[model samples]
Target: MTNLYTGCPKMKEMDGRAVLILFIMLTLVKTEGLVSVTTGSDYVVTRVGENQTISLDVSRAGGEFRVSFNDSTEYLFHKFNNSDLKRVNNNRTLYRDRYRVRGNITSSVFRLTLYNVTTEDAGIYECQKFEGNQRVPGCKQLLIVARNPSQPNITGPASAVSGGSVTLTCSSSSRSLPPDHPPLTMNYTWKRNSEEIQGGGDVSVDGPNLTMKDISREKAGNYTCQAKEEELKSDWSARHVLDVQYGPNTVHFNETHDKVTATEGDPLTVRCSADCNPACTVTWLDTSRQKVTSGQREAVLSIPAVNRSLSDLYTCHVNNTHGNKSRNLKLDIQYGPYTVQFNEIDDKVTATEGDPLTVTCSADCNPTCTVTWWDTYKQRVTSGHREAVLSIPAVNRSLSDLYTCHVNNTHGNKSRNLKLDIQYPPSVKTFSDISINNITRKVDSVSFLCVVDGNPKPSVYLRHDLTNRTYPMTCETLSKSIYTSHQYYECTHTNENFDVFLHGAYSCRAENTVGHVDSRAVVVTVPSK
Candidate 1:
């Protein structure tokens, strides 16, 4: 039939056409999905030695679609699919198009976890579908980068006193990748003036605090702590300076270079030596407690004329930048002992013969004070007692002698002269005619009277020959009295050294501090007619 064109060659062409149609139908079934992948266009940044994630979207891919990584050899990652892709007619072989995904791993997540990450893992990722010689799109790019930790803050003194301890600390914080790409942990080291302190036995590190113990002047300097992380380190923190101080040393005193004794006019030297940051100043003290700034390390004190009054206590005071110190010294000046003066109020003293005598004895000496005296008889006299005397009885003349007074003190010794003279005279008066004078008859009962006058009052006494017993016939009273009726009545006179009788043999006595005297004996005998 033109007849329904049944030629063999023609038939062959018809069969090829039908097969092409069937192939097209099968492609239609598998192409139902919208296969796609998403990622940022810029490379993702990750700190050095940190893990980073690279993602791909397989949502549009058919159920049979799977993923493979581009960097599986150097680093690898797992891919998860959440899309619900299916065959068009439930025929497993219906789809002729195939799709897949690959990660452009630069800082590969797996390698970052395994090996220390360098700056290399960053690139683009892709999701592709093939339709018989035709392919689809992919995600853009991922970037990996290295970042440093921030600088740390430090706190504490830069300089500390000698023999003291100090603490140093370092801390830092950084913001970077996710948990999978945790920042690198770091270690810190301390330095003195930017120089490493390795092998320094005094330095010790514990956690965040660093300690330097018993610092000295040599330890004074600037200090810093540096933090280091994998492939990256932060700048050093601010520096702190340490200063140590100590007191003056090597103390010395200069005074009396040698031990010796000197008199009033002597020179003295005082010098103090010490090591100080600023040099030292010295001061001197005088006898009157006056202070003189030496302005130098030493001082000289000279006395033009040395004397006992110049003796005093001296001291040296030293002041330095660090502190002050001092010492004391004593100066002794010698002189002689001398007495001031001595004298007595009276030239002569009259007293009873048996009475005690007192005299003043005073003297002076450089180191001691004393006094001594002597009487006219050259006898050592007692001191401090003022009176001296001797007595005489029945002396009708005057007597004189020499006495002495003395004074002594620290200065020197001195003496004074004194003279004592005694005056005594006899007087007489008579009453009654017994034998017409000094005689009376035995048992006659004759009356007799006697009187005497003298500078000192007088007394009379009578003595019996056999018994030697003496009895007072008349004694001087402050006032005169009547003795006309008395049988045994007689008068005598006394003046210091002598005593005298008035009538009929009578005895009397006189006395003074200087001497004593006794009157001559007289007898009155009665005659028997």
Candidate 2:
């Protein structure tokens, strides 16, 4: 049997017989895992400062035993026939103060404990058992792991812009071991705000490095890293806060009332704000995109008194290094007509009795004003937009009065007045259904009636059509109509001897300074001759 202690090991030969032995079992301290086995030796694994105890099944042991390290010739521990442990100062292997022997030969049980195990103490440890002249082969290697890794440090910039890329690296180390052994394999883990980071998409983890592309503001936070070597964990690295500079977002407004509409001359005030890192800049823009008010993160716009011109358009803009944002605000003013007047036509209009006339009024107002043309009696003549039109296809003398062009809205109202005068040449119209002067010859006296219409009470007279332009009969006004230009008049021509000489055509003529028009000739005839 060869012991773990190395002073140049010497293997004892089996006397022409092959021995089947797999009895030596390795046990580690605190950590649980499978022990690797190779040809002759089993392996035990543990960390520094932990005790390593290798167990031996002594059911087949001889009463004599010896423990060794790294196949050494000198014994690390020795016992003979249930006696006390032997001194281990043979200039080889582990010292006596570090290892201890326990169990009794009669009990057929044995084990060894290597105390204060360090990286320097890593080697193959084994116990040899002798049964009379025969030897028992029992050996195993004890591997002492170095201490946990040092605290890691993450390296990267303190801040980054949104939509850009970011790369961070972390590094850690621990105590070294002899060149004869393989170094411990290390694994890295990342955390953000104390939550484990699972890499995918734009974010990726390659060993100790964390890489991210097209970063957003939401991904900004404290980041840390930890190192793990063979079930041992290192402390988390210091927190590295990543500040993301981004444009404005999540806009809001503050107003006492709904700004969609308001009365003219009303006081108005509105404020705009948004969320951003590094405090975004804010400004108020006009409909033309001209900057009006500038501020940081928030902006205020005020109007002491609103007017129709200031309605309709307002915008808020915010921006930073990453991008910009804009939003439109609604404002409408309700106001009465202000610029109301006749278009080309004046307030006072004049037209001939038979002439066509058209009068228009124009008005400007907010909230779209409605225009109405009212007559003297307050009757609605026409209605439309502020461009109200009043048309008289053919004007008469009666169409001479004041007309109103009214423009109104929900806020208030406005009106304009226009007076119209109509003039014409007088014309006589026969009254009493007598369009023509007709009389019987037997009738001693004949009377004719006619209606005269004129603007200035024209002179009316009965004329004999054949008597050299002479008004031979009397004509007078009987009654003058109060509502119209109807003047009732009667004209008579009488003769005691009714003859053909005096029976010439008689007519009525109405003449004014404008012109004159005559009626048909009167007739006299014998009845039933």
Candidate 3:
């Protein structure tokens, strides 16, 4: 209130403060240009052999503008001012053929395109506007990211033998990168049959090289490689197939038919096989461990004719580069009954009447023949396995005949004959019943008859005990009967004289090779005339 407007220093100070505030506002308004620049993202990712474009929005600004691209590593790829542009340092030679700038300088939006990007182009890029020597405060920062590495290639053997070793290498090419660019730093990963491969046991990995030791069939599969750098990963490489070779594990027959059967003098054969990658050599061995057939590719063993000696355990041996195996089978040969003979005390079997008789037959055979005994009438007497016997409980003249033993089997048959003889002592039934005329007169012819039975013809005679005289009797053998042969004997006295008084007792005697028998004594009566 002390006359502020009239030469007052306080008013002068307030005025000075207001002017300074206005000046500051004006300066700020002038310093901020009408141009606005914006970007959607700070970083971009791309792959090699692909084109990429970095977009920037510049709006509300008038007059010519400039945009430049640079990296934190001081690699400046491009600089454009209106229609004129220049590439800096050696970067010009690197990007002059592959880089392009699009959109007019007068447009509110501009783009920087890169053709066939490479790992060398991965870095922070700066887009700036410059008027005279002063640089605008607002600038766009572009982070160009490189794509993943190129697809890797694998080189190695396509097939390998089991227990062998192999090596595989994974490699990639980056022709799009700058010549001065450092080697790509990549992490290598391997896969087998679409599964990740871990380094252990038979598998080993060193950088891009993969080695397998003591390879087996289990390790055979499709293989591929992938390369990764930072957060980027490459596509899987082409599949490489590996084949593993091995040998057979076992040798044997196909089914349970492991035994072979054949008849003597017949052909026989056997076969065996094995599972193997490489073919195997087969050989046949006899029971004595001697080679029956030479080594051949086919698994077959053949014999022209089978014999008793050929019937044994045969061995089949199979061999290969990896290992060897063997199988054994039995061969059976069938033969007929042979060498049949009768087992008897002598050629002619002898037995007493009413005694037991037995004759046995034996033969040699493979399957043991079926022995059957038969008489001369073709009747079966006995049967057995290896031997046969014909028995008669009480032998008589009826049983004295020839016997045969027949031995038969699957092969053939054989027979043998045996003779049987029956012997008996002399036996007399009646001595007075002999056929003779009745002695009625002294001159009449009187005779006595004796009936005897024995094996051999027995000698007959009549004896007179009182006179101590013996008169031989004539005997005749009749036809053979069931029991034995009968013999008839006759003793005659033509004249009845003093002999009647001397004949106290008369007896008939029969003798043979076995023993002798005597008939009852009888008296001769003299009738009164």
Best by TM-score: 2
At residue 478, candidate 2 shows an lDDT of 68
Candidate 1 wrong stretches, greater than 4 Å:
1-251, 255-260, 272-274, 286-288, 340-518, 521-529
Compared with the true structure, all predictions reach lDDT values of 0.43, 0.66, 0.62
455 in model 2: Cα distance from truth in Å?
A: 5.0
Tens-place lDDT per residue, model 1, 1-529, is 0111122111111111111100000010111121112113233444444433334333333222322223222112221122212222223221112212122212111111112334443332333332331122332333434356678778877556556788877786543333244334567777887787663577788755778887666666777777765445778887866666545554566534423345434554445455443557767766566885476655555455656665367666677656777666665544333333333446555443233333343433334444445655667655542222232342222222455666554334566665443234334444222333323342323223344444344444443334454555444343422321112224432222111122244344433333334455545444445
- Which ranges in model 2 have alpha carbons more than 4 Å from their true place? 1-45, 53-87, 90-112, 115-142, 175-182, 248-259, 274-278, 426-529
Model 1 lDDT on a 0 to 1 scale: 0.43
Of the pair 1 and 2, which is ahead by TM-score?
2
Report the Cα lDDT for residue 517, model 3. 89
Q: Write the per-residue lDDT of candidate 3 for residues 351-393, one digit (tens) a residue.
A: 7778987777878777889999887678887799988777778
TM-score of 1: 0.31
Q: Give the runs in model 3 whose Cα sits over 4 Å from its true position.
A: 1-49, 54-98, 102-111, 116-248, 253-256, 276-281, 287-291, 294-299, 319-324, 339-348, 353-369, 375-400, 409-411, 429-513, 519-529
**Model 2 over residues 1-529: C-alpha lDDT tens digits?**
3333344233232223222222232343332232223212344456667666656565454445565556666655555443434544555444546654433323345555667667767766555553332244544545545557789999998898889999989888854343355555678899999999999999999988899899999889999999976667899999999997887766677853335677888987788888888887889887787887979989988888988777377888888776788778888777888767786867777676778888777677777789999887788999887577898899876653678888988777888888776666767667322322334544444455656666545666667667645444445666754433344545543444444455566677777766777877666444533
